[model samples]
Target: MEELKEELLSTDGKLDFAIGFKGTVAIGFQSPQSGYNLKVIRNTPTEQYKWGVFEGVPSVLEKYGRVHVINRTGSMLDNIIFYRVKLERAWFTNALLQELLNDASECVTLQGESLFFRHLIVQSKLIPLPVYLENSSQAESEAAIINLGHCIKNNMAANIFNKDLDARNYGVGVFGGVYLFDYDALEQFTEVKIRTNQNQFEGEEDIPEWFFEDGVIFLPEEIESGLRIPNRSLRQLFREVHGDLLQVDYYERIQDELGVGKVPSARVYPERYQIN
Candidate 1:
């Protein structure tokens, strides 16, 4: 940690980094002596300690085969954590660093000799799911969509709800592995309410009951449309293969299992690998 801190402080204006959404900055570097490539992301700190983002839920993230947070340590009340992420695959974030730098004059001004980050998360680079789908072959895109479902289901099995379901919140690895990288909106499934709008509204004046409900309320049916995947066939493929994800019963069933102390295991591998 000390070595990394010293190196980061010394680089200052020489460091290459990109500004991302929700006040994140992605920085990549390689060790000259060890020849190891490393990447880190600086996140906006929250008022309270986050179990999943901090020391509390590494086990859960690992169990679900999510990004492995190598190390997290930092000062500054605003930037509380600095993470060292594993560099196992290619990375493509929300926006290209160059484009963000071009538009962000303020960030450009800040990237001088004294640039410092108070919080950081180190992880492999990932192609934002949307970007991957837009550029890849239809077959690969199909696989990625399926993997996205796995990522969602895996997190749900662990009782974690990624409050944001947009495809942009997810990333695709070069090998077709899809993972959720954003943790800002994470919440416990038990704390979230599952609702439906199948026959609730009659007209524009008919405000749904969930409209008045407090806390996180999720309408399962919206999962498909909420993703906003552009490909019509790919979207249909997702619905056909993982259609259960759009049902209130599916989420309710998982919640029921949790309520009965029957938490599901984090199955990270393909079923074909399972030994009978």
Candidate 2:
């Protein structure tokens, strides 16, 4: 983490162009000493990336002073590049923050259960996105709608479930609501499947039978292979930062909703199944 900080600081004032998807280029920070403020100047897929930036909000400016520079990291399974940077402000206020913190606290208190959770943190809150509510009478409702819309527009649903969703990757302002940063994981999907024919599957064959008998035959695989499975090292880091909050069973219901076993090729929906 220190190394990442150092790298960010070193590129403070400089601006450099980094290639992203086929025709896109991200404007990146040249040096870290310049302080928090970042921007992605260019993008492809019909300029959808620009909407991630909220427009006309004072609180956002009060928080993160300027649009310093953007930093492009690598791509995730979803093909969106990740970038880590610092911002001017230390914190911001929002209902989402309170809810998230409460959830985190509850997860920590309910330890000892076998559950799966993701660890994400607010590195900085000063850098605000340019989102605002058009309906003054319905500020809260507008905020929720915009935030949810932004999440869906940027393919964040996949990342959120996958546990790779970074708070810095999205932000909520006073009446402006949520704005998305980092477009890397947008539109990516990960599927889990049970391997039934492998040579090592002899003893595991019964697992599928049990899952099918239990009416969970739609689930592709166990939590181990889920799209958001946290790496052992990352999990350890989460435990250190957020304690038992990283051990909650947030995905259990979703997993159950998806079912427990893989659908046989012959039985899969014709539109979804591919023939080799």
Off by over 4 Å in 2: 1-13, 16-27, 41-249, 252-276
Q: In candidate 1, what are the lDDT values of residues 1-276, reduced to their tens digit?
A: 455445444543222332223323233433332212233332323343233343323332332233232211110001123432221112223343443334332222223323222223444456677878778887788888887887788777777777768887677655666777665456777889999888765665777888898888999999988788878998899899889999999999988987888866454543233478
List per-candidate RMSD values in Å. 9.2, 20.9
Worst 10 residues of 2 by lDDT: 71-80
Counting clashing residue pairs in each candidate, in order, gives: 10, 24
Q: Give all candidates' CA lDDT scores.
A: 0.56, 0.29
- Best by the TM-score measure: 1
How do the predictions measure up, each by TM-score?
0.64, 0.23
Model 1 alpha-carbon drift over 4 Å, by segment: 1-80, 83-112, 201-204, 265-267, 270-276
lDDT tens digits, residues 1-276, model 2? 343345545654332211122212222222234333333322122253333443322322222222212211111111121233223221212332232234333221222331111222222222222222222334343333334333422331222222224343444433333444444333212232222323336566444443444211222223223212133543333335333122223233333433544221111111112376
